[model samples]
Target chain A: MGTIVSILVLVLFLTAILTGGYNKKFLQRVQGSNMWDWLTTVDHKKIGIMYLGAGGFFFLIGGLEALLIRVQLFYPNNDFIVGDTFNQLLTMHGTTMIFFVAMPLLIGFMNVAVPLQIGARDVAFPFLNALSFWLFLGGGIMLNLGWLFGGAADAGWTSYVPIASNQFSPGPGVDYYVLGLQISGIGTLIGGINFLVTIINMRAPGMTFLRLPLFTWTTFVTSALILFAFPPLTVGLLLIMFDRIFGSHFFDAAMGGNSLIWQHLFWIFGHPEVYIVILPAFGIISEVISTFSKKRLFGYNSMVFATILIGFLGFMVWAHHMFTVGMGPVANAIFAVATMSIAVPTGIKIFNWLFTMWGGRLQFTTAMKFAVGFIPTFVMGGVTGVMLASPPADYQYHDSYFVVAHFHYVLIGGTVFGVLAGVYYWWPRMFGHKLNERLGNVHFWLFFIGFHLTFLIQHWLGLYGMPRRVFTYQAADGLTWINQVSTVGAVMMGVATLVFLYNVVYSRKSATAASAERDPWDGRTLEWAIPCPTPEYNFAQLPKVRGLDAWWMEKMAGNKELEPAEPLQPIHMPSSSYRPILMSLGFFVSGLGFIFRTIEVGVLGLVMVFLLMFTRSFEQDHGYHIEVDQIKEAEKGA
Target chain B: MKANAEQTKNQTAVQTSQESAWKHVTSFAVMIVLTAIAFAAVATNLVPSHLLVPLLLTLAAVQVVVQLYTFMHLNQKGSGFPVAFMASGIFIGVISAVALMILV
Candidate 1:
């Protein structure tokens, strides 16, 4: 199977190269674009849009993988997908969703919204930001390339050591997973640092910490979480890479090494990683609910505190995931308590949302509906989360359908729903058009119903002693009906996503004139203060923030708009360049090289990557800037 | 306000040279103490191989704090956010590591 996949992947690559060479127009587009333009482009909005488009593409691919799994499980003892194929599908689905889907979508939101909320023109390190996005895209491509090859990664997304070890699973698939994620993880880390610096240093004058919008605040904390959470992952991946490529004994239990070390390293980055994925969604829900309800976010201080507390506790309870590993009752009990403690802060956030909606004028926009829907869905996910926190209870649930149901609810019901809400909420700012509300509602209902139908029953199945990750099951297990229902739900989700795609395309032609207008929601944040389809550099002159809800404060003071922080000054904007893309390409080539190092072509590929790196580093150029007068004139025209 | 400004300037100058010298001295002292303790543990066999790793890790933790305060100037003003972020990362790293050690 693996050999066949590899052959197919090679064929696809050859086909792409041939097609590129054959088409003059395509080659021109690829080669004619100035290399420097793409390498250094620092426009936050553009970077954000790129992230969204890339992330959306990956989401579709991951969702398709999910559909495949559902189809396989549709009937008892089904052979729609063989065992190895089933394993690969599950692995790719989990990996794609977490790494390719959730992470990029959150980063996309950050790239688009962070600078705007803070009244900054761009992130502090725009060049690095562009580089991060490219690296991420490269990683995503590498992970998915397994499809063309004989198979995708068959190790579960977590890729536990003994199973992922070279001796047990001798394949290039896991190598692709490790290298792809390592490259992308570097991008995520850089992005985290960029946002941390931007938020801390570049806030508009008088936009004090407390005065910042909730979304910006969450972005700030989330960046902090990323800074802290990603390094361990980097360390773990490096060890794995060394073990796989250089024959290191770090995770080889037979050697003087411990496999547990990898788990520690991975989960250290993993637990807070949940917050890294969810906090931004929490921020989005905060903004959406408040805007639609026409109220100040309830218990603003508590919400802020809860976010911080969750982030803090996120690091503490990672061990709960390890309870069944037999750390003994004392360790288990300690981890269990630590895990349960997270629920307090998470519960606080839920109530805060409900209170924000209480007694306020509620407009049921598509964005708001998702936000409202998130409460119950996430609560169910959360309840299962608490249940799983108990060590003894977890022994029964470990690696069962229950565990699968728990995370899907949290990730899909929590993070995916939040991302969808953000897209609806910011669609106008991003594309100068609203997603068709009618279609959006259809998308939401189908998705919500389908989501519950699929995973909600899995919990019962788990409780009834069904193991997860099984490619097939017998009719006698009584799992057949529930599996059929789950497949139906998966189909519904597929239809909903199709409707969403159509809505996006359809709205391009016939969106209301009102939809084209920026600040359609009479929004409180600084982002809505700018014109729709925000300018490339973002702000002409940074807005002076006076108090909480900076825009709202100005409105209340009868100023009608923000006062400028300074007279217009020329903004030193980074020019777009292709260095980042090229650098990532080098890694992609090197990955292929590592996977097939026995071949002479692989050696040549590795050498080429080294040469590319040296060439790229030596050829750096000072970025270009736009004059203040040009920005002023542009703003005036708007 | 003027007097405060003058005093602040004097303090800054004194602190700059003093802190620089102190930083060098403290780092040297820390290195010696850390080496001595490590050697002593090895000599006495007080640090078992299993505990040796954890002990070295603890030492590294101490060194990190020292580095942050002295080398990174995290204890000083204008260092708040970066320090906070670093601390948070370390906290998360430690928790995840400990969890993985027990769980896996």
Candidate 2:
């Protein structure tokens, strides 16, 4: 399957190259090398697109895993995929969906939208941004490489210590998990720091913190969360790596190392990771809802505070997951309360969205549909979440299909829906074309209905004592009918994904007419001020943001364009470099070597990586500037 | 006019240099005194053994603040963002340590 997928991807790439279209022409401008321009490009927009493409590919792989799991469970006593293979499928599904699909997709949105929303030309460090993407891609490849090499990680995405230790499940599988996540986690950490710096330093004149768009504000908070959260995860991965590769005993119970230390470290990173993905989705939903409702976001300050509060409280409640671990009443009570209090802020956000749409012209755009649909679906998820927060109730629900259902409702109904809404919302800005609304609506409804149909019944299945992480159930277990429903719903969602893919291609072919409109949704944010097919220098002149919804404010004042934050001048743009990809490739090679226990190969890869770093330190490549005349010409062409 | 501007810039540069030199020397003297006091406390048994670790930690913390402000120039103009990030990182670090102490 991996080979077939690789071949398909290669064929697609060759086709794109040989077609001799605009991509070929663009490549020819860069010394006749087809991949050179894009490969070396440090443009945030291109990087963002690459992130989305890679994330979409992983999403499909994760989705396929999901379908297979559904099929395996479609009938009781099913032996389609039993035991360890099932474990691998489930583990890879969760890992890929969280790390590879959801987070990167949100990061892609951030890369495309945040700088634009804040009226900046580029991120604070475009080179680092490119490097972050490459590292993530490399890590993703290393992770899946385990599948081709006889096994994948089978100890679940959480990879609880005792089970993951060499004594029990000794294989290269968990090693792959550790090294892959370690590499990717570094990329995510740097990416977080880059955004924090960019948002702090690079906002245009008059774009104060309060005046910033909701999307940018969420990106800011999310980056801060990522900065704090990913470190513990890296430490956890490193310890496990040491225990496995170096034969240390950080997590090995026999050597007096406490197993729960890994749990603490993992969840310390894990809980905030939930918010790191969700906060950006919240940002996207806020943007889409307000734009479609044609009103300012109601209680904007409260919404911002809610987002921050959620991020902070996310850390306090990590122990809620381990409630049954006998943390005693005090710890359990405190964590439960922290978990429940999160609902207060989440409730504020839900009401804010509702009030924003109240007495306003509601445009039922595809993005708006997803945003609106997200409210009820997420509230249901939240309700279940609050229920599960109670320690006693949690014991009953823990590791059950109910727990699975609750998370899927929240993660799929909240994060996935938000991403789809964002993809529809920002498609025009990112790709210079609107997705076909008719196809988009079909995609939304099918996915929405399919999602509920799939997971909603599983809650009852959990109540009826259906355990999770088990491959099959006996006929006497009475889970057959519900499982069939879930399988059918999963199939519908698969079809919906196909339709969405079709819309992407269909819309691109018909893009010329729609691409002309800069403000496709009569957008409220600063990103809309730039012309479609955003020039390499995003804004010819940085926009002066006067108030919230800066573009809308200017439009209300009858201005055709944003007030320039600065005089028209040559734009200093960063030059592309090959170092980032090469460095990531080095890490990728090192990962493979470590997984295979090839010490010499691993050392060689490390040498290559450090050598690149040494050269990068001394290299002084002052980037070229975009002439003001070129900016003018580009604006004229647009 | 250019020469006048240049003279003023150079003058201010010299003045600030002298002022910063005085600051650096004063901070150096203060940090030395702090170190000496820490050593004296340990050598002379100024505090009970039970409280000594906390006292030393507090002294160390104070020295770190001084070093950051005086030597690292975190007290300089336009350093608010870095200060905020550092302060928050420290705050969260302390919080997490305390939480783990209690919970883990």
Candidate 3:
């Protein structure tokens, strides 16, 4: 099977190169036309859209998984799904939503917004950006590949050890978990490094850290969190891979391997990983709230400090997740206190957002609705979080539906809502089209209601002593009504998601009026100062930043556009390459080989990967320059 | 190049190459001396077994410093992020390893 697959992959790849993907003339023609352009695109905009598309596709899969889980639990002693299938649905739902859906969608927004906000033509390492996407996608595909086999990971998304060990949960299921995440985690780490370099080294002449758009600021901090957080996960996953495939004893207790090592390493990465996913949302909320309110962000410096403080505190509070693991009173107390203190920074952000919208003339756009709606819901989540932080209370909440409620509040209310708000807010900038506001509001209301209905009941159910990750309960437990209600709410959310899908489709069908509005929403950031569907070379002439809200400053100064910081020069843009895709495919193939313990396949795959890297090093393709005349031609209408 | 009648375009190139050669020789001498002392300590059993572990670890740590500074040029100007990232990796590794050790 493996050989056949490899041979087919090689054939298809060679055919693509021979046909058009690599031929210089064919590449140029197809570059302006079809699938080859997307496959080999180094354009941050196209990559961002691809991330969005992939995230949305995964969201549907995860949502279906959620629906299946909820349906099984809708009634007492439900047989909607069996024990094994329930576990698969549960594990895949959590894993897919967190890793595949939220991270990529949020990264998508960053890819589109960060470069424009920083006034750069593209990311500093455009090639690495492409590599990041391919790697992430490759990892995602490998992870989902488990479904095509007999089973998928069933040890929960956390994949707690001893239970998840090969002796307990045999087969390729857990193998998929380790290798899939390891490959993807590498992609995410390099992406983090890429953004860190881009933000620090490629900002426009005057776009200092303080002057940067809030979303860009959050991307920077999130990338830093990724840098520090992902390594432990990589180490942990490699250990598990060794334990599973190579007959090593990394997490095996009979061999004197301590399981706490996995927990500590996982949560150390896990805690920061949540912040990694959420901080970008925080940045998005700041942008949306301030934009709709027609005000500069309240307490820009305070907001920046708050964001950094949250990132810093994110590292110290991983032990909170391990309170039930008998970490001792001193450790628990230290972690509990550290966890609660995080609220101070978070609260500062909350109030600053509120103050930004307090007295201004606010627009009640759909994005604004989500932003306004996020405040109270997130605070509710935060309130519950503080409750959970107390170790004593957490003992009761651990593995309970209440814990589920608390996190859904943070993840969904914070990240998902922020993603929707960003999508709605930037859709015009992203695709040069507007999603119908009335339809958007309908989608928002249903989702918001569904979110509250589902999670709100869960808090009570958890308090009533119901455990989580269980498929069903007895009717006599008196939990039937709430469970049913929770299921109903989840269905509503699914319906709400359908409404959003409709809005996107409808908006695209009638895109005649949506052409490139340079300053839609009267945006206050530098991104808005540029043309919509942003030019390939983002800023023809970089804008000089004079203040925090530079674009707003220019608008107030009665200038129709930003004053040019430099005379237009030929933009030195990086050429697209198929190497990243080839390299990632190598990782995917090798990962599959390891899972099945096929040494020859693994060797060949790795050799192919390294050879591609060697070829890339030797090939000196100095990317073509966009001429000043071409820039003038493109900017003619503007 | 060493011919008496030959002229070099840049005079400083000769001096700079000679200076680098001396530094390399000095570094090599220091490394050899350190290794010899470490070998003598372990082979002669002058250090107790438990104490030997610490002694070797100390020597190995010193050797790593020499390797990085002399061979890797970590002291150079462009090595900031690499140094920071490496230090962070070490810090996290130590924390994890210690936490697990204490827990068990």
- Top DockQ: which candidate number? 1
In model 1, which runs have C-alpha deviations exceeding 4 angstroms? Answer: A1-40, A511-515, A598-622, B1-67, B93-104
- lDDT against the true structure, per candidate, is 0.84, 0.89, 0.88
lDDT (tens digit, per residue) of candidate 1 on A329-435: 89888879989999999999999999999999999999998988899999999999999998889999988999999999999989999999999999899988888
Of the candidates shown, which would achieve the greatest TM-score relative to the real structure? 2
| Candidate 3 fraction of reference contacts recovered | 0.55
Interface RMSD of 3: 2.2
What is the Å distance of residue A455 in model 1 from its true position?
A: 1.8
Better of 1 and 2 by DockQ: 1
Q: What is the lDDT of residue A439 in candidate 1?
A: 93
Instruction: Name the 10 consecutive residues with the lowest summed lDDT in model 2 chain A.
Output: A1-10
Question: After best superposition, candidate 3 residue A251: deviation in angstroms?
Answer: 1.7
lDDT winner between 1 and 2, please give it: 2
Candidate structures ordered by TM-score, highest first? 2, 3, 1
Question: What is the docking quality class of candidate 1?
Answer: medium
**DockQ agreement of candidate 2 with the native complex:** 0.47
Superior by lDDT: candidate 1 or candidate 3? 3
> What's the C-alpha lDDT at position A433 in model 3?
79
RMSD of each: 4.6, 4.4, 3.8
Choose 1 or 2, whichever is better by TM-score.
2
